[model samples]
Target: ARPRVGYYYTGKTGGTLFNEHMKKLTVQEFQSIPVVINDSASVYDAICTMFLEDVGTLFVVKQDSILIGIVSRKDLLRASMGKQDLESVPVSIIMTRMPNITTCKQEDPILEVAHKLISKQIDGVPVVRERTVNDQTVHEVIGRITKTNITKAFVHLAKDELHD
Candidate 1:
């Protein structure tokens, strides 16, 4: 059966809320989980894993899970072409620092996120949260949201609406 259009509108409206009422509607509802690496991990390893995972970017995090930097496929490829020794070089040496990284929260509006992706020319955003656990600082990684996910969600919602 064809999907219902009103259902899609209702879903979109519900997904647009940025406050506590914003429910986790789908994988698109949350930021994409940042693919991460350690500071000491080899650049070659980082590149290989990212390719295996089929992701374009990876986040470099400390042992404590504090976000440190990001590395993109382009960055890795560029580094590979340079004098840098991928097997010996650490990800920290090639990563883009935190000052340049863009992130989002789980409660953020999906539409706003879509705009950010377009304006920033980024494929995805990392979802993060800060919380205290046992009197220590902790970062909680919730999930990942991507442009493909958004498009698929839109199409599914549209089809569902047409049927209704």
Candidate 2:
């Protein structure tokens, strides 16, 4: 294994290179635009926004894009079946509140986010940045990582093989 000649196999294979490339992929490189809704919005509004955005999940936030909660399609479906009028109800009532929400930063590995999406059995996760608001820690919604984003990254990763 001594470096005696040029172009000698260093014992690294294509698959190994691919694995290394995948591990280095970060969430910022593959995340999509975050879909958000005001915490005060109604369930009806949430449903409308979901449809309009064509996204599976929505981040609920306050005035400054500070993440307050998250809402999924399943949550909206359940809320619709409730006896209360959708307009009269606030989305905050159905959203999975902060401190309980699963979030990732821009620098997080895409593979890690993919693992989270699979193990958590969720549709998406918001990419956030932490900030201090009145000495209180809050997350700012920046982007989103979803199964679709992961799939795109996978496609891009395998693009080199397409030429062969």
TM-score of every prediction relative to native: 0.73, 0.91
For 1-164, candidate 2 gives per-residue lDDT tens digits of 65676667768998997788788899999989999999889999999999999998999999989999999999999999879999989999999998898999999989999999999999899999999989988899999999999999989878945775
Quote the positional error of residue 12 for candidate 2 in Å. 2.9
State the displacement of the C-alpha of residue 156, model 2, in Å, after optimal TM-score superposition: 1.1
Write down the lDDT of every candidate, Cα atoms only.
0.72, 0.92
Put down candidate 1 lDDT per residue, 1-164, tens digits, no spaces: 44666443334454455332323343444345567778789999999989888998787888766777778888899999998678999889888886587777776666666778899988776676777878965565555567876786567656765685
Off by over 4 Å in 1: 1-33, 132-139
Model 2 alpha-carbon drift over 4 Å, by segment? 1-6, 161-164
